[model samples]
Target: TAFAGVDPGVNESGSYAPKSVPTSKRGSSNLRKTLFQAMDVLIKTMPQDDPVYQFMDRKRTQGKPYYVYMTAGANKFLRIYYGRVKEYLSVLPDPS
Candidate 1:
């Protein structure tokens, strides 16, 4: 999604239906690049039992290209990060 910027795009017809995955131009390219590099490092250093690496390995075994695997991993990382951060924030004491 927004993390990797690969959210699906609406068709040219402008209906609600999405037709293809398109990179959104709104986010910081540097952050995307950092996520990609992090993904590469994770694949190299993480244990095989790690869920993220397992997902990447499954995609690799399925004949997906390197970029595809990395991008998917980055997206997964972002989704996890979002969920964890949201939970952490919700537990904070109210300032009011």
Candidate 2:
């Protein structure tokens, strides 16, 4: 729901719908650099060895640092977010 560098070589602008994968913020027709920047914020907010990173790196452990390897980490976060959204699609079945 924000805009900025969400990737290294991009400055995309658009809502992040879970309809497809966001490999690179750059060259994306609807993405911007801000998106990458936004993800960078998450990197700053969270710890270097946070469980999120663990979840992201669960498949494989490269010699690169977690923050430095944000491409895979962010991709994992996105996938995790998608799963959470699906798991909690409704809050108490809409008590309006």
Give me the runs in candidate 2 sitting further than 4 Å from their true place: 1-35, 54-61, 65-68, 90-96
State the lDDT of candidate 1 residue by residue for 1-96, as single tens digits: 664564444446545555445556356678888888888888889787667788888889999888778878877778888899999999999999
Model 1 pairs whose backbones collide: none
In model 1, the runs with Cα more than 4 Å from the true position are 9-22
lDDT of 2: 0.52
lDDT of 2 by residue, 1-96 (tens): 222223443334586445334444344434434444645665567565766646544534656654445665555555576788988985448766
Clash count, one per candidate: 0, 20
Which candidate wins on lDDT? Answer: 1
Model 2 residue 26 distance off true place after TM-score fit, in angstroms? 8.7
User: Could you say which candidate leads in TM-score?
Assistant: 1
- Give lDDT per model, in order: 0.76, 0.52
Q: What is the lDDT, from 0 to 100, of the residue 69 in candidate 2?
A: 54
